[model samples]
Target: MKKILAALVVLVTIGTGSYSYAASAEKAFARVEKSGTIRCGYFTWQPAFMKDPNTGTLSGINYDFMDKVGHFLGLKIEWAEEVGIGSVTEALGAGRIDVMCASMWPDPAKMFHTEYTLPTYFSAVYAIVRGSDKRFDGNLNSINKPEVKVCGIEGDITANASRAAFPQANFVGLPPTADGSQLILSVVSNKCDVMLGDAPLLIDYSKTAPGKIRKVAGVDPVHVFGEHLLVNKGEHHLKMMLDTAITTLVNSGEMDKVLDGYEGVYGAPEKAFKPLR
Candidate 1:
């Protein structure tokens, strides 16, 4: 009886140790600390986010925020693959990256797979059509037709919302290949009849490309949502670290300074971003 009891105790100890090892290994934040790198996943969008294709350099409100975050964690920010809206959930779920560098909005579908740090900003989502195309002039409902080819960034909140708004339209997604500024490119190039994206971004885009695309006057968002960065599921440690960094920036007014600069440069509306509560 003594020998049997001893063996059971040994088994229990081994099991407990194994669980501790597995849990530590599964933690994304611990891995980040060991590696000293945060693999950040991002996609191509411009005005005030991601990289500029012409210069092949990173800039924008998102970039500034990540820079501050990297400074706080003492981790080098390594740009990972440019992930699209369509596959961000899969990429994060597979542990392909440590963090999502670009901002994401809330969606029930996405919430099922991953988790978010606190929201960073609120951007107005809008509908854009080629300036010469009067087909959707001021009529949001008219856009929901089979002939209209609507394109949006795959995995984007706008993509999901656009589908809800224009269910009958032949909506297509810009694959990851078109990840950078391509959704807007599609509308301006006439590859699609409409592009649904951030209002300020599209407005800024219209200025650069001149008379190519224009927002439909008074087109309301399909719904309201806030932009946020993402962390792998149950990565509470990583989530807390990022949330702290962002909240620090907000409290210090540094984030607003960066946003103010971008808003001036990108023509973002005054009400587009508000300080976190």
Candidate 2:
């Protein structure tokens, strides 16, 4: 008799919890529908969400995704350009933005009141070096050798990883907000030995100054990689909406279509570390 009573309690608890969750989700969805506009956060990261110089319009893989998502929900996209990747989290926390799709990594420390959507894209870290610098033997392991000078973005995971990966090498933290082109220029100009960063961005920069920059083979191991989008936490409806939209995009090959549109600018899209759904 007691066993049956306990089972009944468990079933009741589960049913109540599910119904409560559904109620909250419906409420959030109604709120968004009433608003009629979804404020999306944008950063200046090229080929991700950037302003086109020729047309003065915002267009990129991230922008394209948000546009489709907004359309699907019958909401207009309102752009709120942020200065740096860090600002994307800040804006989301302050309730200034409804969704964040700036290629921002979903760091735990920055996730206060923010939720990460499915990882819509991925890229690996590459060791970008000047063509004349042959110290790196095309192997990332060589970067940790003693006397090697390695530069990474300051206050980022790359900088933190540098100490573990290259305890013997001299690790220099470059300012995080510096443009990708400028970062590569610093290395190409001999201001730094090697620039460690996203492989696609480095590959894109190498095209401008041919013969000056070259990428070292082998990507950063899984432990050191990141992929994500940021949205308001507790917004279950919004989260599900995004998840469904991403899954549809991935399945219909629309994700590839959008990414391919910017392939010329950002290089080939890397495989997602996890399922888009």
Candidate 3:
């Protein structure tokens, strides 16, 4: 009887431990379902996700896309916090936000902490330089030298790609909170000789600072990456939920409508490529 009781106790303890593990694994999805809301952490990225400084109004492609997604899923989306590129995954890991509402480049380093949904669209990263600079006009290899200073937002895709491509070059990294203009400023002020950036972002920035920056002539795009929504790692249920919604929206042409509405408001649509089915 004593041995049997000890065995039963061990069984109960093992079962309890397994249940706890399962509960922890599904915590994010369970919380969202219970609340009927998906709290979002977003970063301001022009037409993708923007906040009007004066009015605090939010309007952008992802904003509309996610809104429609919530409607389809019958869940409310709360734009709970504005997160920086460096801290977005940290927020997810800490359960501070349910997901990142804005579309992001799936940087490999972030994969350990976060999971990405199916891509909604794609963009190209280009090497930007001062308009008058022609040192690397056709010779992309020249820019990889150690003397070249490359500027990029810290913890962003630009910085990651730049580091990978130009391993020998000097890197001038801005804080994750720095805006797009700061990247151009790094080049304008000679703080950096080159900066890698998204094509649309650079195009938009060029309008405000004409003749200040241009993509490297004769060199192809440095990299092209898909734009995807993000959730915490191990949250496969939530990721699949988003993936299905996005795929449905994209297939039904709803995603295109959102992109069409933003055309020329910023230098989008022209630079944004639709995702291939």
Candidate 4:
């Protein structure tokens, strides 16, 4: 009995040490501390994120927020435009980027790969139709018919929502290569009849192609979508750090300042961003 107790105690000690090491290894914030930088990922979207047309400097609300986050964390920000909406989830799951502050919603489908921060903004699907295309109005019932070709990026909630909204409508899903801007351009160029996307993205579109295309109706009442930051799921420390950073920004008014700058530059009002409560 004494020998058996000794063996059990030895086993417990070994298990405890192994668990501690594994826990330390899985923590991404600790890894960041070791490396001394936060690897951030952004995407190609105006106002939220954009490569400045003249200076080539990256600018936007997301950029500003991330910069502030880096300062708060006492780490250097090494940012990159990593992937589009379609590929971002995969990039997070695979750990290609430590943090993605881009077009991500609190999509339950992505729960396995990432821990989403509190929402920073709200977006709704809007229908973009040519001013001259009178076939379909903005009404959901009218656009849900079989004849409408609703163009959207593949593998997005927008595409899913389009299908759900208009089961009879011929929903055309483009490859991930086609982003929000491309979807809008498709409609403007007559390649596609209608473009469906988040309101913010569509708002950006209306400005560029003024009077050519209009929001067919109004914002969809479907479950509103939003943008949230994502970190790998197992990285509890990283998640906590990011969450703290996000909360800090949202609280400090520094986030508001950055957002105001972007809003002014992009001609969007401060009300455009939906605070994550």
Best-fitting candidate, measured by TM-score? 3
lDDT, candidates in the order shown: 0.72, 0.64, 0.80, 0.66
lDDT of 2: 0.64
Model 2 TM-score relative to the real fold = 0.75
Ranking of models by lDDT: 3, 1, 4, 2
Can you give the TM-score per candidate against the true fold?
0.80, 0.75, 0.86, 0.79
**C-alpha lDDT (0 to 100) for residue 87 of candidate 3:** 77
Off by over 4 Å in 3: 1-24, 269-277
Candidate 1 has a TM-score of 0.80
lDDT of 2 by residue, 158-227 (tens): 5555566677788776775655666677787676677656656665666675677777644554242545
Error of 2 at 159 (Å): 3.4
Candidate 3, residues 1-277, lDDT tens digits: the string is: 2343234334544866653424458567768767888999888777687788999999888899999998878788999898887778788988989989888887988888889999887777788999999999988889999899998888777688889989899998899887667788889899999987776677677778788899899988887778889999888667767887888998898888887886775656433454453
Clashing pairs in model 3? none
Ranked by TM-score, top first: 3, 1, 4, 2
Off by over 4 Å in 1: 1-25, 52-55, 269-277
Backbone clash pairs for candidate 2 read: none
Candidate 4 residue lDDT tens string, 1-277? 2343234334544766654433454445555666777778777776677776687788777887787877777777888445777677677666677788764656566686678877565555467777777665546577777777887667666576677767888888878645667777778777778766554565676676667776665445444566678887766556656666777777777766775675634455334536454
